[model samples]
Target chain A: MRPDWIAVDWGTSRLRAWAMGAEGVLAEAQSAEGMARLDEGGFEIALLRLIWPWLDEGQAVPVVICGMAGARRGWHEAPYRMLPCAPVDPQSLVPVAAEDARISVRIVPGLAQSRPADVMRGEETQIAGALAVLGDFDGVICLPGTHSKWVQVSASEVVSFRSFLTGELFALLSEQSVLRQGLVGEGWDADVFLAAVSDGMSHPQKLGSKLFALRAEGLLQDLPPASARARLSGLLIGLELVGARSYWLGQPVVLVADEGLAERYAAALAAQGVQARLLPARACTLGGLAAAIGQLTTAVSGTGRKA
Target chain B: MRPDWIAVDWGTSRLRAWAMGAEGVLAEAQSAEGMARLDEGGFEIALLRLIWPWLDEGQAVPVVICGMAGARRGWHEAPYRMLPCAPVDPQSLVPVAAEDARISVRIVPGLAQSRPADVMRGEETQIAGALAVLGDFDGVICLPGTHSKWVQVSASEVVSFRSFLTGELFALLSEQSVLRQGLVGEGWDADVFLAAVSDGMSHPQKLGSKLFALRAEGLLQDLPPASARARLSGLLIGLELVGARSYWLGQPVVLVADEGLAERYAAALAAQGVQARLLPARACTLGGLAAAIGQLTTAVSGTGRKA
Candidate 1:
């Protein structure tokens, strides 16, 4: 039986599922239930609700799931596959067997680094997608998201990567810290933000102590919240830039992210005199999955195996 | 009437009031609550309570206040006099007339920067003391406290200075933010703290973002909380170092602070390759107030008047 759907990317806080026809043409798409909404019911029930609208009366659709859905706490625990190798194909994907379910669902395992003991659930697909699109670009590919991943891709494979909690740090600081008192009502000051970045770069040693100065200087001197927020942002981003620099110094870097994050990275790169371009994350994910599927189909044909 | 005794010193958290004899011997020492505690009671009441104990036994001892007690919300709100000027003396201090009491009191105002509108309530006294002792040292003097002040002293005149909010940031970030989760059981990791300082100094741009990385990385990689806390401390101190470098770049620096704060500054300065000597804040404040008083008395006597 030929499957109607091709891929699905389910992550913490969000979910995305795409449908493809026999020729890899995106026939139709449907999404309703998000991963954040699913808690009690298992993956089978959740996946069914998401794809039920696009399903025919009696058609069995094979769906491949990636991201947090593959984590230990997700629908089913898909084991981690280390780096220096290609991502597993859809057919070779791990199956979640339910005693009372009829639909077949496969989940992709996440990747882990032994030395750092770091594990990533959704970034692997994005890296795989980046590799598929770039063909064989060496150096580091930074995937910035809620948890930003700095992956080192060499020889067409993800050699190693370090995850910097940049986004989460921003969220925590902006919304939670005393620095929150210094944030403006709406919009951000690019000039202030950039200046803060410069300040961070120039006085990296004073980074830790200077944070309080924001409040002291701003409060005593009455610096505007927008400027304070910008400084806070600059301070955090500056720290991340330093860590990321150590990993990919003088290397051609490709940032895989959405538009907003891409712009932020671009600004940061410009400050450091490094050029970076943003590659659409979803497109790369699709391309990478397609490549994985193509490899699997070719292998099956070469082995003369029956479906 | 000559006061029985004079007690004076500027503290970070609180202003110290003293009951002294004509010989300036310590008769009785009392803390008039704390600067942090003054936010609620309106400065007048806070000041009265500090000297209330000394006013017992039907003796109305004339009281003099220096430090934060001289700020806008303080007792009389003495205006800040800029640098290249002598500290305002108790005799020449601004008098706050009590509407319903016979006890006379005066409040000494702090110095302010006109452009930035930055003001220091208690630091001026310490600066005066540093001047009294050194008389002519052309170097940067750092007064480390809750609101640490880094002032440039040149031949008995303050050229320029900047304040860093290092201590407060540490308090807020460690106790308030989600980073608290990572710092729950961890005491203090000097190595981690120092490493964080280096990391902060190297990449000031990313300092702000690196905070949340503590928790996220901990959850994903299980980084110890003590290490996270140390990183936080290091980050803050590193930032301070960055800011302080400009002021203390090539010149010698004298760090005037209490024992605990002095040690912290010493560690941070040593890490940044800057030489610093920790002078007790209490002694400096006393010395500063004494010098200011001596100058004020001389000015009054020379003008054929008495305070």
Candidate 2:
């Protein structure tokens, strides 16, 4: 299939790109060279090395990027669209003029919340893609990762959302704190995890005490490393769920994240009697970026200008 | 003032010793050789190095040791005395024999609460010291540190306690987490701190979301580093107070910690309409150790058994 455009999900530490032909992806490429590593002038060079195989020699390839690559400090300054707005808007896309005419790129703008002062960059694209799958869905979307977000979407608009430091807390507690003394790097204990989750959901305020208990048990009762690790993960997740109860309770929920993280969130939600529809994180990003690409394609085709 | 005995507080990273004469401390010395850096036999060597100059030739100068030096993994296994018991029981002291007869050492046992599986080695001695000043007072004792503890004391007996990782969380969040990116660390914003404390106390369940907001506010609102730092500290401390409300509410409260930490706790308490009597940590430790030393002195004078 002949390539129609390109889709890129550029994050802080890593970047992924796909050559989207008329029907589907023709080729794909990835790199560790994300926004964190590259300066303003280096973005084009970095993109070309990965997407060169798909770009026509003279004609410019339309590239829609979604993530930190569009931040103020990133490749281009793509300002945030306020809440109650569409997840992905082609009109809001910030165009970046490259030295080479081989690529025409428009980076997706993120969403910003003022009262609580929260922001989302790459996840907005995922939300747009997930919305595509649900099609005019009025529900909640939960994306679990380093920073887990619970977003309430209504009529293709993000009504309100909250981000939790669940994953980061898990990482710090398991690897850096005294809790690390009892945790193994790998292995899972479902029983211990569930019990701890239940405990956290029941007594969320006692989280600090419970965290130290992981270490105390290790010293007093000789708790196994795997169980401790699982419990740590569970407790943190449970605390997140408790905090996020207002967002997902009695709402149609979608889990948009990687396989493992999605599964963990799904299981945790299941314990609370809430079943969520799981969507691949990649699919959501692709669908969201495709929506942006479609708008550009329609605008360019009608105006006799290439997208 | 000739030296009578030594009062030593041997903790994880630091050690302090005071040469107690008949009336008061004759001299004092300190070292970085804490229990964490020593092995089973290294304890005596470390202790001796700090108190060698105080010991009289061929006479065993009694030394009353407190803190982590009494932990099972510390110098010797000085087991915990169950709660609803005395804070520092001379009868419960774990004896330590020395190759050199110039010093006689006995470690003070810590207090343990079984229901919650909580343990404290050093703080118990602090509690004993605070109790000595309070004189059979029945109320709550708040010791803020790496592990901030709230103990319910009744008639000189430690009834029960809960330990919060408030200080640890503050250290980790301020220095290690993404929140660190926005903290100035030195200046204190009292208004920001109090407001955050109120916010945290009102909705303790939103701790995860609230924590992320600190970083978000930094990014979006360009929150000053000091205010961010103060707010972070306030939020965590407020969360702990909410959890520990059952201990301090409608009861006389005493803040037993270092001058700085105790003052902060006192301020937070005052925000909640609670005035806590501040107890200097050193005074408590010295007074507590002095009581233990007095016990040994009386026992030796009567039963002919050295400390």
- DockQ values per model: 0.25, 0.60
Looking at model 1, give its docking quality level: acceptable
Clashes of 1: 35
How well docked is model 1, in DockQ terms? 0.25
lDDT of each: 0.67, 0.85
- DockQ measured for candidate 2: 0.60
TM-score of every candidate: 0.66, 0.87
Q: What lDDT score goes with residue B278 in model 1?
A: 68
Q: Candidate 2 lDDT, tens digit per residue, B67-99?
A: 998887788889888878878877778898877
Candidate 2 residue runs with Cα over 4 Å from true position = A1-8, A12-64, A72-76, A95-106, A302-307, B1-6, B19-64, B72-75, B95-106, B301-307
What local lDDT score does residue A57 receive in model 1, on the 0 to 100 scale? 45
Best by DockQ: 2
Q: What is the i-RMS of every prediction?
A: 4.6, 1.1
